[model samples]
Target: MTQTLEVTQAAEVTQAAEVTQAVERPLQTAKPALGRGLLLLMSVATGLSVAGNYFAQPLLDLMGRELRLSTTMAALIVTAAQVGYALGLMLLVPLGDLVERRRLAVSLFGATAAFLVLTALAPNGSILLLGTALTALTSVAAQVVVPYAVTLAAPEQRGRVVGTVMTGLLLGALLARTASGALSELGGWRTVYWVNAVLMIVVAVLLRRHLPKLHTPAGLRYPALLRSTFALFRTEPLLRWRAGIAALSLASFNVLWTAVTFLLAGTYGWSEGAIGLFGLVGVAGALSTLAAGRLADRGFVQWLTGAGTALLALSWLAVGAGGASMWWLIGGVLVLNVAQSSLLNANQNVIYALRPEIRNRLNSAFMTAFFAGGATGSALTSIVWVSAGWTGVSVLGGSLATGTFVLWVLERVRTHA
Candidate 1:
């Protein structure tokens, strides 16, 4: 009887050990934590890379003059870049899983740097468009780095790290406008691209030397990998829900920014410089990104989503009313900025949790949808502003915000039920 009891106890202990290892193996295989300095480097690299797409936005008029193109033709410079970026997001970002991410990202940086210089050297409008397209396509380098940040983090801290990197991306985009405007005014529009090219070179060197080479497990062939993205969307209910929220929230945010320029200039008689400066004010709100991440780390996604959607909706009230007062406008803009960052953090928190191995594809799908929303909102703003005027545009933006709030409510009710 004693011998039988000892054998049973040994079996039970062995079973427990196997269970523990099963639970721990995934975490153990995840990439190790990145140091603070390297994380910061990743953030900086991401920011500079994304900024490549926006450099031409404020320089269109100057380029038009130099290239002997009409205003309509010059505007396509920004459009071409944006289209290339969207294509790269879908086509290239997924490659992160199939290759050494640091190698891929650095090579893109070098390629984009060359394209930026090519853009600056272009003698005609056709060449200029070609260079711009190529530059923005490769600038998706930043998107690849995002999943690299996630893979470097522990499962528990993934949200926090993602937030930090996103904050850098947002800030860089905001500053890009301001810096481009200032530089184009002081030097020439071409100077902006040249300076950005040099920065890209520096980032490439830094990444090659300092960024860790994260291991890539064997992956599906490129075509199968691309096809799998669609399968993920079909299967992942949470991905669908989070993606819908991202699209709606981003649309609301873009509607406000796009239409507000018309309001500031027409209603308030603000100068172009003063209007450009509003991008700086939006920076104050981007600070919410890190806080949003921490909230996600603490498992407050649903609550954050509910509250963020509400805040975004309410901010439109101030936005709609701000036709009367500049202070009201500024307050609404700040709230709008904070709410967007929070909602973005919340959405990313959910999607990043869904699949660890396919993170790049997940981010690509989410970001691509998010960009579509922005494009739709931009198009809508043009029509709404022209047809309905200020009141009409505000109502449209407010509707988009309210739609998000409604989506959150439905999600909560469904979960509880």
Candidate 2:
């Protein structure tokens, strides 16, 4: 009787062990190494995709003048693009899990090319706004490429791979304005759209030739996939928390950039050309995301995030002083970029680690939250800049940063508890 009982207990233990091994085997299995060429190509694809939303920012004045728009009405062009991107993040990015990612990405670039032409050819403000919105609506191609990159990378290397791609994404945002400014100066604002139209086709061809096709389960139907994303907010605590942090961090980042333009134009009387160069300054911070990605792999994610949020708060103090000193503003914006990039990378690392299969959907949710915050910050800064000026804008941004730190601390405490 004793021997029979012992044999049964041993069988139960073996079954549990089998279950554990089955789960870990996938993570332990060798994943193909991502080639440097693929990484570079992916980076460029992501950058070009994201550049669609930002191209109009520097060209807003030119566009407004051409479209016969009032100042208040002209700003909507940028807002329309932002809103379109947020919508795409929610509606379109989830399709990555359902379809072949390479196809989806290539298709997005092609569609974006069409819309860019529409924007370039727009005869009036309304049509131009529609074209810009459609371009951004399809340009969530960057979001598609990012999660696809994560899937191709071995589990251990996901952080570094994601970081490298993000560098391109950030650089695209930084450089697009400069390029738009130059193109607009040489030709007209419409020239920027025409150039990007051709560029998007080139990008699509490059991506189609190089982007890897991963073997994922056939994805859910569209509605279920999207429904699953919002359900994630309820089901996954980490996703919700990370999304909030991203939103807050992005909100603070937007507030600074939005208000800084006013400070340069109003206080320093800087030309549009000079004002455009500051985007270059922020590129330094974007480059640091690669290091931040490596650090995420080394562990200490929480520490890195905590430090970033703290710096974000502290950077605001320097930014607040920018009203008095140009050096302070330069130094502060650089610090702000570092803090923002690092924190965002850390947040993605954490969320991406949570549920591997639905990375695109998870990303869709995270980025949607992020853009929503950006839209908020843009709207808020416009109001504050008018009522309180630079000082008021600084205080508002600082308070948002401080709130970000507090949220980070509370999360850490709660996680530990």
Candidate 3:
């Protein structure tokens, strides 16, 4: 009886060891990573963040005229937001890995909400500019949150995941002008900010409870993190040149739209309400971001990016020809926005493929160039418009698009070589 009891105990221990080994083997096996929930959350957050950044675009003319700002000075308000966003990407996004992201996200949302209120209440242009910058800086919530989503996805699925989230981002950027214009018509520009303030707060609350815990590497010193970001620029030649293409393309995009407000209102006598309706049309093109993203996932980054850049050049030419012809202008606007969205998504999707471990830092480097190009575009647009006119603006816009095409060709050659 004693020998039989000992034999049963030994068999039970052996079975338990087999079960443990089975569990460990599956963990080690390669499997497809799925992260749709993380993508959904990122999309929602990104949409909200983009909406906040662009509420001022369509209303710039109205606000500037009402506030007694010079054209260039008024333009600065928009540029300031871009500058602030760039700063946030550089300094704060890297903190995603170093800090508790959920807490940081909530705090930034609250801070941005407060600043929007400040923007609504500001008495003068300078105060309004400062408030706008603060609001944009707060919108970096997307930058932090999106890259975290990329980390959760499988390496193979990163492009699709990033593209899916960016669809929300593109929608937000395109819709913001429409929402702002329609809201401003009903209750003035201040009302637009007021409404978004509440929306952001709600998004913050949802994220706080629902976001999954993410892992960040431990023991990364500040200098090390900074060095990693810098290294991307130095070592990643594709990232470097791709970013330049993105910058040039973005510059032309901003130049056209920033100057269009004045031309549409002053030259064509178009109402803000009418202009806002055009943004709705642009949504058709904006929706293509999903397709662009999926294509990037299929290893067609160079082709998608190259085609998108060519589209940008054509759209600019169309807009230049159609100046003041409402239908022509509207058609060009739709094409331009669509092509730009595709190009932007293509760049982002390709970058996501390169860096999984340092997504935040990589994103910061990419977006910094994106916004910096936007800032440079906005700043130079007024000068070009004043010196030459809508036609001149079109020339510059088209030429920049052409430059992006050259950059794309360079990227492809380098990649194949």
Model 2, range 1-417, lDDT digits (tens) per residue?
A: 999999999999999787566544433442463688888888988888888788898888888888888887778898789878888999999887687667888999999999999999998888988998999999999998888787778767777888999999999998999999998989999988888889899989988777665534324688888899888899998887788888888999999999998899989999989999878999988999999989888886887799999999999999999999999999999999999999988998988888876788889998998888877887899899989999999998988888888888878788789
**Off by more than 4 A, model 1:** 1-30
- TM values, all candidates: 0.91, 0.91, 0.84
Deviation from native of the Cα of residue 94 in model 1, angstroms: 0.7
lDDT of 1 by residue, 1-417 (tens): 999999999999999787566534543654564878888988888888888788887678789888898887898888898899989898988888677778899999999999999999999999999999999899999999888888778778877898899888898888998898998887898888899999999989988998776655434898988887767779887777777888888888889888888988999898888888888888966788899889888989888898899999999888888888889888998999999899998888888877776788888888888888888888899999999987887898889988889988887777688
How displaced is residue 255 in candidate 1, in Å?
Answer: 0.8
The TM-score of predicted model 1 comes to 0.91
Clashing pairs in 1: none
Candidate 3, 38-138: lDDT as tens digits:
56766977887878788887788889877888898788887788878887888778777566666777788888888989999878899999999998887
Q: Where is the poorest 10-residue window by lDDT in model 1? A: 22-31
Model 2 misplacement above 4 A: 1-33
